[model samples]
Target: MNSSLQLAVPATRNRAPVGPPFRRQARSRLLRADLLTVIAWASVSFAVALWLADGGAAGFSTPAGSFTALGIVAGLIGMDLVLLMLLLVARTPLIDGAVGHDRALEFHRKLGKPSLYLLLAHGALVAIGYGIAEGLDPVGELVALWLLVPDMWLAIVSIGLFIAVVVTSVVTVRRRLPYEFWYVVHLLTYAAVLTAIPHQFSVGGLFAEGTWQRWYWLAICIATGAALAHYRVLEPLVATARHQLRVSRVVPEAPGVVSIELTGRHLDELAGSGGRFFIWRFLAPGMWWHPHPFSLSTEPVLFDSSGRGRLRITVRNLGHGSAQLTRLKPGTSVAIEGPYGLFSTAARSRDRVVMIGAGIGITPIRALLEGTPFEPGNATVLLRGHSEAELYLGDEVLELCRRRGATLFHLTGPRSAGEHSWLPEPAVHSGHRLASYAPDIADADVYICGPDAWARSVISAARAAGAREEQLHYERFDW
Candidate 1:
């Protein structure tokens, strides 16, 4: 096995900026992450406080009043949690910068079942409380609510919608459903929230005419809507206009792999390191609506202070949208959202670095090789593929590693079905592990990009090799 490629080849020139790449503070990110946690919990606490401020304590003394008061608090907390979920996924810069877009999305998903449960509890408690007050059964009171109360029917429908959303979001169910179908179902959350809001103001005793609770709820809903519109809608439009990215050329890298080069104005102002990502929407027939999230294969190269430069993304025809991308023509306009993810040096916590990439996943590692700073022997690169051609831009990577003084290893062979190691068949037989290439991997920040299962294998090996959680970084790009 030719695993050890020549280290010191003829130095090839690169387009990276002269000097160290941009630096990010791990401390700042941790502090901001902490702040977000405090705020999320504090919002729930504030909801309870709002209830306490308005005779909530005295109402709980009587059994019927107690059920009514608890119902009100449950509704408030459920509403708060729902709103927080929306804000988490609004693609807000604050959340993305603090916890990264993926982590924010993870938090968003975790709240689904809890928020649904709270809403269900709110409805049941309110029905029982009202039934006791009116000397009717809970079912009779619920029937009266649906028939007589304004917007109560809509609230009932909202509960059904919330149940549908949560059921589809469960891991097993989500796995069986197509993503588009899941997305459409999840969008019903807004409809559910809107339908439920009317009863909060119209029927709830706490939010009676011109009460502080009414305005507070109104403000939060408005703010959440505004944030969603700005970040997810307006910001993409503004960026499309400001940068004006257009396809310059499309170059085929290997079978099923192509690189799309895009040129735009002020590309240097793009606020991300080489390994970060952007969600791209190419404006063309049948393709303009589909968004593709891809990391830069090459960082932007600005020629002058005018910020006129080019950016490139290497794509493999993994799906329908990417297959369409491989056929893109020159001069096609593009709209974008982000430069998000923690796959860059912004995630670095140590001086040394180890980068691992398998198959087409090596593209982002190539960009990182060009832009990240490291001393001659402080960085290591491992490329895993079934063959050399599967390396997809292996030559360029080798050049970059040589120019940047980083070690490079090529593990190319068939898979080993026995042990399921991330290394190739030959390497697995030889007992090579993640630490074999980069012995200091435990002290280095390890960046991995690849298929989900393969990346998970790499992660497991890295962990077994003593790599800390914070020291290992990877991005899961799901649009």
Candidate 2:
């Protein structure tokens, strides 16, 4: 096993700012998808309601139809409630550290808009359906609506939550808020979710038919409540009490790269393999609110065999929090959390290994090759760069290959069709490389980590060559 490790010193550099939504994939297209999903959900819901109402005939019955409608509305209301709560819990900074801020943001995007639409549909349907049944004038119906059916209050709360999610999702507005402030506001989602549950129980449109419906609602209530407690209240508290991480040293690496070493009680608990990432929060001056994901560039061992473990994370200064990391000096306390993700040597264990890296994404692949135990001649490192100058850490990788007895292939120009094949670089003979190497791709496990475009290509190439989905592994860090 290798013992000593060294990381590059950090240096400052100009970085392009991250614009709204990160990359430009016109909002109009995304809105179109969202609208389609809304229409689908509403249609499915109405279909289910029509079936339950016995083809809309029973819908006219007061006590009977109202009870059935109550069950449908309440169940839908409960689901929306629970979803909103989970979103809020996920926004907490401590929890955010577990998955990283970028991933959490992505999750919000997937679930947020649809959730708002579902809630609105549920509310509008209930109001209109109930209004017609009561046979009252528009003004009187609006005034005495909640008086006759108090569950509308839950719909009111759901509306509040929808507004909150919309406001937070806006890029220009959210950027102005502090991380802690945003976290607090996000917690309101839990309250909204819980508040909606009672409405579900009281208005049993879906739940009135059988004991199973009540049981299902009860199950949802308990499961959602438990998850909220753990993610929001319990998980972070455990990190604080158990890990108690503090940054022991910060060394400047080459431009855009910084080495951060952390120490805490029971470092053995913190020991993890290479390529695994952690959500790090440096709370001290000069490091604040930059809770982003970083790859572990060093082995997970106590400072020494007899001491606590130390971790080295190489961060490429991409934006706000990342740029500030270059200014960190030793003894600047940090709350190191997470050992999340599964992009490691274990995923690469096979007769032959092929690794690819783009720009700073090479950090994790570097650790997997260097920190982990491996036999010689089993793995090959193929590194591609735009130019020799852009090669972030090629020397270290070559040295690692030399130590492990693996071959290193470097391509420092624009990639071509057959450049990756062992056949002559200018001409890629796809069959020759496969036959000479692992003829049966199903027997080989491929691990890839890097930029989105590069990772996708790797996956496509592997699959095209007949690699099983289970036999291929990858880590995607794209925002």
Candidate 3:
């Protein structure tokens, strides 16, 4: 195993000026987030308004009637939410550019349980309400609906599939399953949606033939599906053919850590700031079906005259899926899905920037240091690891810091025993903290990537040092 310490001396140059340009970009991102929030809530309101306009409130005069009316409302809203969740994860460029792929997925995860609950409640309440009207028990009514109502059986199966999807998605359950197993189960979500659609049109009176409400619901569902098809399927195929990325070589950086370099056509057009990740699929047998999200460890180098460029990503074997990547041969075709995440220059809100990373997470910081805008002395990079070798790409990061005039610190050693901290034991014992390394962290944009718990600790230290939430940018390594 490789274990050693390397650090770059801090540059004595003056800091860069903080100007209107960075602040303008930050404000624009903020606006986009706000707009997304408004649109989501407005959709729910619109769903409810459709029923209200159809005189849905009159049915609430009786207890059974009230239950049935509320059930209808719940189903409408729940279905709308399901569509919203699909759009959020559809890789829509507007949403990806606005909140980034990671944040959009975060919101998508948050909606999962709630949408499932709303759907369950809609089923139960509708059954109970109808049972009362028919002088039958809830269970009896459910059976009757499943057996006698056209398309209702499919709806019941849809609910069952949704339950399976959500249960498998629970953190504990998900941890027990292989990622491929979990992914296969997740695909049932589309089947569930399709199964549920028939009952929505056939049984729901609000969506009967010639109704405007039916048209609106159909449009939303079609749009969500189109977005998924276009962005997730078609766009990737087009990009794969257009770029023609092929693995040029794989160079080991450390034990189990390697950098995969690719040569592609018009690569500069796909280049974003460093630290942004792309979802890559190697079109080789056994691995062609699996996609890996890896950040570029170096900026794309383009030879303008030839429209040919090279890109590189440093990866460490962290799981079975990634371990297979180490064996990939030269000339392997690669399909890409993004330059996602906001952990790049686009997220910079200040003249000074501080990059913190641990273990394999140090790779993206290396890329950011090379490409993110910063005056030589205005950037500070802190890398942490249990051993120097664990700090993958440390030498390259150190070299970049030196050439770019940024300060670099390598914190390598065992963890602190007394407190929950990201610093090494020696540094922790000596009273070093995040603020100690980057004294102006309060005014700097702090970009952090690492293990979940360790990253949280660093985030806490940064917050304690007066960094606002908006000033902290993080890319989570865990899916």
Candidate 4:
């Protein structure tokens, strides 16, 4: 039940800066992110270039010709955008390490509507263009196309699936749906893509057989699918088998929070850099399919040279799946897809560090504190909650701060009345600000994990105190 800091190297008060320079680390990530942007836009440009290379421009001499050409272009970019969205979520290390889970996902979600509109435009514009060419109505042309290929209706079915997937992904719809419901709906996306492919290549003359552009499109599609399979499927299976994880105990930490400790072979391999998280699926009758993304509450504790050890993840009943986990039996098998995201020392851009957490969001911050290097008095941790009991792992975090010689502050009270303040009412009235606690915040890498609104307030206050975008770090735990 108790979490002791791992890597308890004898405390050295005179430790010097040992990590890579802050500027280099920040610049590298920015470059990688820019590279991804360039690649995405270039793909769209290349798709259009392919159309032009094949004499697509001359088709615009007439109104019908113009409509058909534009439709083809829309389909090209729309499909490419869809593929880009898939690739972003495929759990590729290159993407995760560079842009991170939150940023990559933000971009992925933003693409949903535009891609859908483009695909719909492709269908309607082509319908109108071909109808005018044949002296028929748009509805008549659609019916003809539907009849021409018995499977063309699959494309229509795909359109419906796309609509459903995107709608559920909307922030409003998503907030109202159960996690399981939303997850199941998203899985249909693969089916939607598969269904749409047949009509796309068969009837869309742009992808006609023997065309080089068709082969190129197929290659990218296959690549996207392969990335998904390798990272999301095969990699997880390998880790699950290699680690051989099983629940050893589930100990209560508070009224609702608990720490689930697992014993596994080769556990050290799963212990990635600071604050890494894993997607866990307990192999049980009713919980085998649910994915729980949780960070290690403490570092891995190896018992022998064989790499067999124990690891722990703190959990609170945030949803139905998590509530069921409180009853998990010891010896339950665990499947994992791990060590993802850059919420660790890997993202450090400075020597000083400021960590702020509230509620269960404090779990990852605790893990980071245990493993991340910092000189005595150079690090500070601020824990917020309505009461001390709400601080999920406050005692352990306090002990770590003591052992590491870092400053620690516990802020427990009703939130302040000020709309933009993240501090307790008393502190706000006392003229407290983020810089009041961490005077070096502008020079430090700030890590924040809390309720979305509160975290945003902390970030805003830090920025107001001169924290660079590169120095601010936070991960969205909203699933």
Rank list by lDDT: 4, 3, 1, 2
For candidate 3, lDDT tens digit of each residue in 265-369? 988776665998889999999999998989998888997856699999988998888998899899999999877788888887788899999988998898888
In model 1, the runs with Cα more than 4 Å from the true position are 6-24, 209-212, 417-420
lDDT string for model 4 (1-479, tens) is 11112223245555545656766887888899899899989998998888788778997999998888888888888888998999989989999989888888889999999999999998898888999999989899989988886677898788889999999999999999988899999998888888888877777476777777888889998999999999999999999999999999999999878999999999777665558788999999999998898889999999998999999999999777889999999999999997888888888888889999989999999999988878777788988888888888888998888788778888877788664468887777777788888899999999999889899898999999999998989977874
Predicted candidate 1 versus true structure: per-residue lDDT over 275-341, tens digit per residue: 8888899999999877788889987888789989898999999877789999999999999988887
Q: Estimate each model's TM-score.
A: 0.92, 0.69, 0.95, 0.95
Off by over 4 Å in 3: 1-20, 418-420
lDDT to native, each model: 0.85, 0.58, 0.86, 0.86
Residue pairs with colliding backbones in model 4 are: none
- Which is the winner by TM-score between candidate 2 and candidate 3? 3
User: Better model by lDDT, 1 or 3?
Assistant: 3
lDDT of 2 by residue, 1-479 (tens): 10111232223323223223311222333344456446435644654454455433465477545643654554464364345336433444333323334444556566666666666665655655555667654455545755666676665675687569567756676778865576677667666665666665565354555545456557655765676566645765677567666677777656677778776666666554577676677786655555667877766556555546676777778777678877776776666545655465434324555666667777787887775444454465655555554446667786777656655665455455543432223324233343234344555556677777667776776777777754566776743
Candidate 1 global CA lDDT score: 0.85
The clash numbers for all candidates, in the given order, read: 0, 15, 0, 0
Question: Whole-model lDDT for model 3 versus the true structure?
Answer: 0.86
lDDT of candidate 4 vs native? 0.86
